[model samples]
Target: MMTNEINKTTGLIHNEGNFVGSAMLFPFNGKLFAITAGHNLYGKKFTDVPNLDNLTVSDHTKITHPIRCILGDSAFAKSHDIVLLELDCKTEISNFLPIRFCTIPRNPKHSLMFRGKYKNTEDPVTHRAITYTSTTTQSEHKFLCQIEKSLLMNHNYSSGSDWLGGWSGSALFIDNHKELICAGVMIEIPNKGNDGQLLFVNTLPLKDLGFESDIINAENLDFDKALNAASLAAIIDSFDEKTIREWEENNKNSEQLKFLNRKLNEIYPPDNIVKNKNKIIKQLLAGKAYLTTELSKNEQIFKQYNSAYKVYNLDSKEFYVNTKAEALTQLSGIKSSYEEYLIGNLGDDLPTADIKLLAIYGVSEWIADCSLDFLKYE
Candidate 1:
């Protein structure tokens, strides 16, 4: 069965602002805006949380839309996870580097596979067996649909997928019927294992948020907009698959390691010294020295993580990254943490040192050891 390829909930965010999560993007007043969790922004502006510098993931793909964030008026939009925003300074919206919704509307009352894009690619990639989740726990379930594709992108944040500290304001969206629509903002997630089911904010009105649990909309926004304006399909379908394939190939060769590179742009390492790679691999399987020192370098990778503490600031998600890097660089010395899916236990009343020790590790859903006495490092 071909699983419906759920388009990703994504938007290109630029400019400077605060009190928002990078996972949120919504259209407002004809100008596109980056929507986010209000708490992420309402903190001190430009520090420790989602700000312009931190929110912009790849400046090479900057969004030219106006940026603004005001306390959301749910009465007007009827969406609580939403906030009104305007872009900064002088910028006009362009479809060239257009935006996407992180969340997409769905008819649970109707039968359809949920799907979305995890990262941008030259050709639209499709995945089957889609899984969607939401963040709220009050008798209603909300979810950011996670597609189980093998792409090395945001496929597994709760399962060894390294979702960075500054990815909140970004929207999780789906590309539906050639037009892209948002489904939810990437709110915080529980990292223990369920991948922060509570952090997902589905655009669809979940029963917990007090909306129709079994309603489906037939009106297609993209089709109507195109007929009214006579514009091309939303950027997702507008792309030429061949051209994008070539572009993706060139990028992978330039960007990825030779062994892990995908088929689209896969190539061998240039050095002839790497010839007879299979023979060398066999020798290593038996016993070899090439890996002796090279593999040894990773022994104390956490030691270098001290840079985060040295450069601590109330502002800058970099600080958070540094702290996490510090704790994770030494996964060998670490034992499994049984915190039941809260990433780093941030919302807990655990002691400071225990919190520090746990914050630095990655959360893979593989069941952990249960019988061994627990170990907590300060």
Candidate 2:
């Protein structure tokens, strides 16, 4: 799960009709931003800012455009190359992995984990190692991170080339207790040398970027908002008005509605969901075609939904049975169906099934899990 989360955080940056390097989705100030090494966009020069129209980033699942770019302004920022691109707030960025900005100084004793995409691949990869030492230049603005060995050894590289060229903008993280604590961004391999040492601009300079007070500690990071956004995004992507309306009408007075309403309020405050409900519904309905095409590559997701639909119905009261005998029977039948699906015995039972069926069933399951009041009756 940690690996998957890391993969979602990093993405490929493309501009000028070519792949540049990699970038990570950074959440700050109740908004999302993309961060990468400054050199990726400015090249060797620090002052060169390119045309912003063509710059875009992709996680391979979706593409997002930057609304504005924020360059590093302080001496600390220029010494340690860094750039932040403010992403469009309305874009679906809910799938990004939650990360905490490290406010405290990095400790060399802790092992480091780096995640980024190679220039040739769409998916991101990871490298883990311990920092050998950290050096400070005379300018006192940057901290050079020297690792024990080459991170490129795990990859199949052609002989005679030892430079880590394609990983300029990768994110360096410290894995502490299953939480990803971002330490810095990989700026470059110093002088293109092959000494198995790399340079990272420590994250401490993020304080100079006007976000010092907002720097979240790994322990205090609240993931509830992100999780709520993810759930709402899924519903928007696979939206079916009839199914949702029916479910809402039936569960209006139930505890499920109360819990869901609370989550909705938390995500979009001041009753945004209520005020823009019709507009959002219309937009989601119109986007169905585009979303389907974009998600067609992951057919397994649809298959899982279809299998679950066959196992249970959203409107069925049998799923909320009061007796142990009835619960066991339902569980046994669901297990049997799942086993059959796993072995490919149930081939295309509902090939043309609406993906919304899965959404309804998923919501029902979520509500049932949250309110297990029927268990007391048994």
Candidate with maximal lDDT? 2
For model 1 the local lDDT of residue 96 reads 21
lDDT per residue (tens digit) for residues 81-185 in model 1 = 434344442333432223333223432211113222232332223332333543345313245444333322344433422333334444443333334444455
Model 2: per-residue Cα lDDT over 4-56, one tens digit each: 46876776677865778777776666777777887777776766666778777
Per-model TM against the reference? 0.35, 0.50
Query: What is the Cα-based lDDT of residue 12 in candidate 2?
Result: 67
Q: Cα lDDT of all candidates, in order?
A: 0.32, 0.54
Worst 10 residues of 2 by lDDT: 219-228
Q: Ten residues in a row with the worst lDDT in model 1?
A: 363-372
Cα deviation in Å at residue 71, candidate 2?
A: 3.7
Candidate 2: where are CA atoms >4 Å away? 1-4, 73-77, 103-106, 138-141, 146-150, 153-163, 191-193, 213-378
